[model samples]
Target: MMEISSAFASGFQGFQRASDAVTEATVNINQQAAQSSNQRALETPVESRTGPSMEQSLVTLGSEQINAEANLKSVKTADEMLGSIIDLRV
Candidate 1:
């Protein structure tokens, strides 16, 4: 009977050790997961919201392009007129 009791005590100790090991492993895994989540949050950029509307930006760009094209046409017309005047003089 004494030997049986000793064996039971040893078995209980082994079980307790296994439980403690499982608890330690769980804690380590939770810590690693939390750290990885924090690292990812820090590495990513926050969403941007403040900027010009897409339509408005496109309209401004189109206006500038039209103004530039008109200026180029006027310069070409002036150059042709000057060339014609030079030809007449010649």
Candidate 2:
């Protein structure tokens, strides 16, 4: 069905978005890790720790991984459906 192609496209887009988010989360984690505690303390007040913390970045990374997996599954399902359609036609 036409929906199969649409599902494949949607899944690919979702996977791309998840991959980008994972990259951003990794970058945020690296930045947070690279910044010295002393420098952060001096620059930001105790109450003003506005940037993403290591825990949050890690969580984001995990969530994005799950999202990517789900998207990949959708893509595989679409591929299978397409293959079935071709087989039936033949």
Residues 1-90, model 2: lDDT tens digits: 889989999999999999999999999888776575656768954454568888999999999999999999999999999999999999
TM-score of each: 0.46, 0.85
Which residue pairs collide in model 1, if any? none
Candidate whose lDDT is highest: 2
Query: Which 10-residue window in model 1 sums to the lowest lDDT?
Result: 45-54
In terms of lDDT, model 2 sits at: 0.90
Question: Candidate 1's residue-wise lDDT over 1-90, tens digit each?
Answer: 344445445545544554554455455555555655776889864443244444444554455455545545554555666677678999
- Winning model by TM-score: 2
Q: Which stretches of candidate 2 lie over 4 Å from their true place?
A: 37-48
* All-Cα superposition RMSD per candidate: 40.1, 2.9
Residue 56 displacement in candidate 2 (angstroms): 0.5
lDDT of each: 0.53, 0.90
